[model samples]
Target: MDIEIFPYRVLGSDTTEALLNDLESLEDVKRTVIHGPRFPKGEATLPPKYRERRVININGEDVVLQVKTARIFLEITMESTIDEIEEICKEHIPYGFDINQDRSNYIRKQQTVTDRIKYGDKELPDELVGMTDQYSTFDDHVKIIKKDD
Candidate 1:
């Protein structure tokens, strides 16, 4: 149901952006979550090449990348999708990576009290659930990227 991709080293913004773009394009990928320490405030003080790219273009939408990619959790439908994901990773994460089908709750798959209180009776789309940062308001975190129909 879910697979975790761990790179040998934390990935930079360009690699993360390329990997995410490829993964999001796959039909079997339902959702993807990036887990790691976020770029600290005043990160711009670092050299341009070492700086965390705050924004990246994915499927034509600009998204702010909050974290340095330590791990990537993906919800996939078919087993074959794992191999496809590996291929995409090979191209982007050239440093090598490991994929595990761990049954851990990497991402919240169900709605919570916060969801009902925040959304009221209107059904929240499956794609939108668990995409927000608990530390920040929904509007501050999620940049709704409209995928092609």
Candidate 2:
């Protein structure tokens, strides 16, 4: 399976930078790239051209971190199961952050399978549903799911 993982968060001046610095220190991470508003304004408020890419505030400042958005991409050649993928994600993703995957093509194919099963054209098997919840650029509305250590 081929997969891409995007992990992102909003933190308070220098905090985002500090987090990026800390991320760079991690041995598991292969690369880290930082991008913000072309010119800093305040948090979440970006130049119109970059507005669509906005995620949330960066450390009391109105900035979104793109490095956090493009964390890792993997191509699994072995027979690892989906559980293994989920475990890897949980291990690397920071707390109180959001993760998104550009799996539109995968979802579309799953939908076809789902439809076939609904029509009795095929047997119903285990299914996975992908849904995205509304998020704010301020990070005020989102809550993180805690994991057992």
Model 1 / residue 138 / CA error / Å: 1.1
lDDT of 1 by residue, 1-149 (tens): 88999999999998889989999999888778888897898888998877895789988888889888899998887999998999999999888999999685566778887777667668888877777545577866666665577
For TM-score, the strongest prediction is 1
Cα lDDT of candidate 1 equals 0.84
Candidate 1: RMSD to truth: 2.1
Cα RMSD of all models vs. native, in order, equals 2.1, 14.3
lDDT of 2 by residue, 31-113 (tens): 22333333344525766654333544422334443332334333333333334545544554546443334553222214354
Superposed Cα deviation of residue 15, candidate 1 (Å): 0.4
Lowest lDDT block of 10, candidate 2? 127-136
Q: Looking at candidate 2, what is the lDDT of residue 7? A: 48
